[model samples]
Target chain A: MHVFYQPDNKKHFLETDEAHHCIKVLRARPGDELVVTDGRGGVSKGTIVSINPKRVEYQVRDFYQVPLPDYRIHMAICPTRKAERNEWMVEKMTELGVHKIQFVISEHTHRETMKRVLNPERLIRVALSAMKQSQQFHLPEFAYFLNLDTYLGQVEAKERYIAYVASEDIPRHLIQQLSPVRPVEILIGPEGDFSTAEIEAAQAADFKPVSLGDTRLRTETAAVVACHSAVLAQIQ
Target chain B: MHVFYQPDNKKHFLETDEAHHCIKVLRARPGDELVVTDGRGGVSKGTIVSINPKRVEYQVRDFYQVPLPDYRIHMAICPTRKAERNEWMVEKMTELGVHKIQFVISEHTHRETMKRVLNPERLIRVALSAMKQSQQFHLPEFAYFLNLDTYLGQVEAKERYIAYVASEDIPRHLIQQLSPVRPVEILIGPEGDFSTAEIEAAQAADFKPVSLGDTRLRTETAAVVACHSAVLAQIQ
Candidate 1:
């Protein structure tokens, strides 16, 4: 079933983008059945009542709720220098299921790179499309780009880990360190990796140091691995 | 340390591309030390002896080998309709460590998509870059695209699995099904998924049906998840 996002349960109208996809793209007609989610766990089966080029209104025939997962996954990553990589990461992370995503800046993030443009709206659209594609009801919340310390200060989770390539002592693998059914957050650094001071601040903030695997993963790959590891850890 | 690929340990010259990257991109001096890998486990530290724009010759100062992982992961996937997605999958799988990657064409693969141009050379370049970037000594071998039945017949592994979305009973999750320290091969279907006949052929070939996770994943995401799961399972 093709699912559409309609964030407001009370509003029968689909948003402009969703409406365009439905009416202009899919050519959905009046009386056609539609599956819609408010993306807050509310899913409704509805029939299209009316359609304008920009407006699609539906009448709900049945409503149900998808129970939220027992554990939450929040991924904080240093946005890659390339926009496509960041977009790809967001898309995959959504498909793998994340509760929140935040872009962080560390000492190693170059000033020119910091000035690089990001289209949050585009990322949100990618996430929404991924959520629907993956049959997920909850859209991941996006946090603004933050400094590493600032982001760590407001951190709230049952467990947190920073993926770092330590020069000295080897850290435990993230898979082994993960406890089942616990809300977890993971931090993935930029191509240059997190500075020593950033790692120390994260440690002070109570984040454990964990390695994803033997290979040195790209920032995006590390994020996906962390997300999937968290999802798999929750299964048992 | 910048790493270069010199597949032939006996040959002191870097490959053309690696030479260009080293000389043109990094502008390394003649005496600068370089880390080079044969990609079959041999890693050597060398000092540049001569530099021509297209040819770089080095003297081996120290030679070492990275021991192979106890287990192997082979991923066979249906190439995504989009070339970028396929390239991305190859890059990530190499970074995450795959012994072999085979592209399969199934019944549902459209003739048009089959004719869709794929640049194998470019993909190999991506894989090489990823192997160097991830600091892995093993480069994944790529098999030519084959028919599903032909591919199924050639499979040899301690364990094999096909990620499928069944309409009936839920299959065992891949993570739970994996046995530690065993060579494993996994197959990921196209966007439309494996047809019933393809799934049956795999089952007949002793490929167990397994689910990656609850959420639906794209062809590329499923491939990465399978690759990572195999890597994680081998840790024990």
Candidate 2:
């Protein structure tokens, strides 16, 4: 069954874009059944009651609640030089069940790249698509921080980590440092990585320095891996 | 320092494409230093002796052997419908330190997609770029299997898994089933998962059915997660 995102569970209609996608793109007609998620763990089965290019009305047939993950994962990552990589990270992180994503502007993130201004609407569309593709009920919230310090000052989680590449001697791994019971957050820097001061500041904020694994990963890859590690740590 | 892939560490010169990149793109001068990898375990530091667009000659200053991972990972995955997604998978898998990738055609893989063969050379380039990007001395080999059975019959590993999504009740996860001391192989299907017969055949071949995690992941994401799980499992 096709899944639609309609944040208002009480409403019998989908938003304009989603409605257009249903009526025009998918050719969804009256009486067609579909699933709708409020993106807050509420899922409902609905039958299309009326459909138009601008509006899609549905009748709720069943309602259910999906439980949120016991642990919360918030990734504060500097967007890569490439826009698509950032978008890809958002999609995969959403699929892997991260609770929130805050795009950070780190010392090493090129100022010119930041000037491009990652469109929030585009990122939201990517996240929404991934949430639907993965059949997930919850959509991860997205935020942007002007700099790493802003993120460091604002975020709170029981377990905090910063993914930094250290010298040959291994630091503590992310999985090794993860607390399955506590809400967790990880800081992933840009391609050039965190400067010494940024790293020190994060450490001062109680964000333990951790390695994702032995291999060197790009900014986007590290974000996805860190998110998955957080998700896997909760399995037990 | 820029890293280059020269499979023959004994050679004094890099191959055509890399030579062009070093000389024409980066405009390296004589006496510049670079790191070269043989894509097995050999790593070398070299000083440029001469530079040309098509041939870059270097004098080896030091040679060292990087130890192979204690465990091996082989991923057999069906190519996603999107060609870029497949390329992205190859790049990420290589960066994550997967040993080999075998593209297989499954029962549900669209015939049209399989007809448009995945370009081996392009995939190799991606792996090589990733190996250098990740600053690793090893490159993952790529192979194509006509069908799932062909892959099942040829590959051998100590731990085998098929990443199949089952019902709501959680199944055994990949990390939980991994053996850090053993070589591992995992099969990830396309958007359309493995057929019942294919899963049965894999089971007969001693491939344990495993879940990567609770959330639904795209084929590429699942493959990367499985590879990382295998890599992480060896950490102990």
Candidate 3:
């Protein structure tokens, strides 16, 4: 069954955008079975009741609740100008089972501000697409914009780590050091990396400095690598 | 210091392309310091002697031999339709430090026949760029357009693993499972994945099945993940 997104399923049906996709693009008709997700862990099985070019209505037949992972992963990443890099990061993070994603403004971030360029909705869409592609039922929360300090103060993970290139230690005990039972928050810097003050602030916030690997990686690649490493460590 | 690729640094002072890049693109002048690599294990510090557009000459000042890693990793993967995916794989693999890369033709490969879309030279150039970007002195050997069976048979790694999504009783072992290893070869299937016969033949040849992670990833993503995971397991 094809899954559709309807954040407000109780109040409104899938809007024209999704309705057009269902009725026109997918050729979904009356009585067609499909699944709809609210992108907040609510999944419902529905049968198409009314199909029209402008609107497609579905009657909810069954609703299933999928529990989110016990250990939450919240990533606050510095955005890269190359949209593909950010898009790839969002897609991979969604597949890796992250709980929340926040785009943070950093000191050396290439794009001083992404208010005009990137569409947070589009990125959420990408995450949703990746979730469907990877057969994942749970959807990660997406935050549009937040500065470094604001994001740092808001993070509520049991354990937090920041990936800094200049750190002398190679983080040998990543898997062994982290608490497997607790939630984790990992911060990935930009291409220019976290500024001196930014690193100091992160350190002040009790964020342990962890090294992803020996080699230097781009901002987006580092985000994916860090997320995967954390997930693997937690699972193991 | 700029890095240049000179496969035959000893015999010829300049390769045509390198000479052109040095003279025209870089506009190197006499006494300028540049690092040149033979793409093998040899690196040389050279100074420009002449700035001829076609045959720019450079004299080697100091030569150093970088030893190869104790474990050699050769990943044979099917090329994806998106050139960016292939390029991203190469970059990430370089950062993770792989010995060699081979593009193979698989049975269920979306791109059945390699039509020679991207220039082989361009792939090498990308590897070189990644090597410099990652601050690595050695460039990986690139093997382009090989049949899967022939390529698999040619590799003489002490241990070989095939990454496949199959329902078997194989215990999930991270690359760390192959502790105290030497030469290792990992084969990643295409988007559609390797056919059953291919997996069977690989098993007959003593290839172990390994899983990278729980979530399904794209071809390029899987290749990079396997490469990084293997490197981490080996180093740790």
Best by TM-score: 1
DockQ of each: 0.85, 0.79, 0.49
Per-residue lDDT of model 2, residues A7-88, tens digit only: 8899889867898788778988899999999999999997889876688898998999999867899998888888888889
Better of 1 and 2 by DockQ: 1
Q: In CAPRI terms, where does candidate 1 land?
A: high
Model 1: residues with Cα > 4 Å off, grouped in runs:
A115-117, B115-117
Report the first chain's TM-score for all candidates: 0.94, 0.93, 0.89
Better of 1 and 2 by TM-score: 1
Instruction: Please say which candidate is ahead in lDDT: 2 or 3.
Output: 2
Place model 3 in a CAPRI quality band: medium
Tell me the spans in candidate 2 whose CA falls farther than 4 Å from its real position. Answer: A115-117, A166-169, B115-117, B166-170
Which tens-of-lDDT digit does each residue in A56-149 have in candidate 3? Answer: 7888988877777678888888888777778888988887788888888887764535764457878878888888766677788888667799
The sequence of per-residue lDDT tens digits that candidate 1 reaches over residues A168-227 is: 777888888999887898998888888888888998999998988888888889999999
Considering every candidate listed, which one attains the maximal lDDT? Answer: 1
> Model 2 compared with the native: what TM-score?
0.95
Q: What is the lDDT of residue B123 in candidate 3?
A: 77
- Give candidate 1's TM-score: 0.96
